[model samples]
Target: MDAQLIAFTGVSAGLVAMPGADFTVVVRNALVSRRAGIACALGIGAGLLVHVALAVVGITAVLAAVPALFRALQVVGGVYVLYLGVQTLRQPHSPVGNPQGGPTARPLRQGFVTNALNPKVSVTFVSVLPQFVPAGAPALPRTLLLALIMVAVALVWFQVVALLVDRLGRWLRRPRVARGVTAVTGAALTVFGSALLAGPLRALLRAL
Candidate 1:
């Protein structure tokens, strides 16, 4: 593989490995149940496919061109994430190692929505993926191929995280530890959402 491709792989892997909203979500679900964790990971992959589809179809460009529309999406996504954080914080701690294995539907939907609504994902695909595409290559196919690679990398990383959490279920299930995990994850989500909103909020203030 060429240097660019290698760089792309390294970058994508690094990004996937880094703890972020998706990581937090997956870990949270894993603490609940192995099934929930797997479901959440798959949901995130599915959501990424949606982003790839949009980027391939040129919606990314449209969003970039329309500042107001992009800002509106940012605001909505930010609010949704913030709400999720608050909801997580309010959930009472339960016995560790005794996962509820929540219905598959909830985590799946939550993962999909959380990932799909993230503008950063869209921006990354639109702006970064193209850099690795070879000149004269069919842009659409190349972008799709790159998206698949990213999705694969993300799935593997998330699954590993799920497995680790499952193995540590005993420790994670302790009341104090579980509460601490929940609180930290909740705070991280809130901070992430607030950071996302800051840009749009500032722009709106300037406009006013």
Candidate 2:
């Protein structure tokens, strides 16, 4: 509806899906097991749908109540995002029970849960959407439309990323740098989480 709103949503989606914890998840899935990569990608997409729906309800409810409630969500979401980053260092390397990069094996449920369980998704839906959705907009339908836009962005972007990774599978298998790559990915996830946490932590400090 508003240009600022669209820009905010675009920025949030970009940041959320970029080479942070979520991107790490996709790459890890792709590099490890092909089907799982796709599965995880699909899971992430599905998770967006769920999060947007929940966010619409949550945002609407909060809108009806205290104005300050939105900031509170931002603080909590920042903390949650940081927690996810910490998890990157120890992020599970399990192959999604799928055969190595094979089409026959797909862990759809696992993919769904992995993305669904991510706190950052909720943060996107809750804290991020409210900043963009014009107040008093047709609430339900508008939220759904915005959510669909988000989902389309995720599906298109992530699926391409997965395919790109697949094409470069050989390079990733290089002997000298594979372990190093894994270690770096873990560190990156932690950094992403830490960076996200920084903003809210600063907000919290200012509030004091």
Q: Give the number of the best model, judged by TM-score.
A: 1
Counted clashes in each candidate structure: 1, 1
TM-score per model over all chains: 0.93, 0.64
List candidate 1 segments past 4 Å from native.
1-3, 92-97
Give Cα distance to truth, residue 32, candidate 2, Å. Answer: 1.9
Global Cα RMSD, each model: 1.7, 5.8
Compare the candidates by lDDT and give the number of the best one: 1
- lDDT of candidates 1 onward, in order: 0.83, 0.61
| Residue 203, model 1, lDDT | 98
